[model samples]
Target: MLPHERSLVKRLQSQPFALIGINSDGDADKVKKILKDQDITWRQSIEGSTRGPWPTKWNVKSWPTIYVLDAQGVIRYKNVREKAMDEAIDTLLAEMKGAKK
Candidate 1:
């Protein structure tokens, strides 16, 4: 995911796109090391230790949950990856482009 996400970030740098990560690892030191080792540069926030973690609030029960949203912030795709994820993003971008013209 690190490398693929990095490629995605680079590929879509000029587009209205962003990749946000919510890390749930309990070891802050390890997390920091992993980020540095993996060269993760996109926006990332450690999952809070509140009563309701982001996973609970967002109803996520697994790691690597992916959601693809459009400009309107609607969840147009869920759990998409690789070529499917790319297609979903491209379709949304094309739709946005067509709507403006």
Candidate 2:
């Protein structure tokens, strides 16, 4: 997922897009090391404790959940499959571009 996500980030580097990760990893250090190793440059909010407030607030019930939000912060896609994320992003990016004009 990280590799695919990295590719999306690279492909959309010129557009108004962001991939925000909400990590529920118990160990901050381990998460940090993993992020560094993966070359993940996006902003991530790490939950140091298991099933922390973030997950509860967001109502995340799955291990790996994907939420694609628009520039206005409205959720445009929820639980989007990894394979289809790029297409969703493309749609949103196009919408954003149209909005700007």
Candidate 3:
């Protein structure tokens, strides 16, 4: 999934797309190392603890939950699978482009 997402990020580099990651890993140093090793260029925020306020605030029930937002910051899709993510991104990008024209 990381490989696919990394590729998507690269492909969408020219577009008005951004990937934000919220990591629940407890160890900050380990998370930093993993991010660097994994070549994750996107901005990420690390939760102090998995059972902390961040999870409760976001209502994250699963490990890899995803929320896709549009240009206006409204969540267009939630908890979509990887394949669906690609389609959603494409659709949103098209909408964005259309709005600009």
| Cα RMSD, model 3 | 1.3
lDDT by residue (56-78, candidate 1, tens digit) is 78988767788999999999999
After best superposition, candidate 1 residue 83: deviation in angstroms? 0.9
Clashing pairs in 2: none
The TM-score that candidate 1 achieves is 0.86
Where does candidate 3 have its weakest 10-residue lDDT segment?
45-54
Between candidates 1 and 2, the TM-score winner? 2
* Per-candidate count of clashing residue pairs (backbone under 3 Å): 0, 0, 0
Worst 10 residues of 1 by lDDT: 43-52
Worst 10 residues of 2 by lDDT: 43-52
**Stretches > 4 Å off in candidate 1:** 27-30, 48-52
lDDT (10s digit) by residue, model 3, range 6-78: 9888999998999888888766797898899999887777786676577879878888878899999999998
lDDT of each: 0.82, 0.83, 0.86
lDDT of 2 by residue, 28-55 (tens): 7888888899899888888865488888
Model 1 clashing residue pairs (backbone)? none
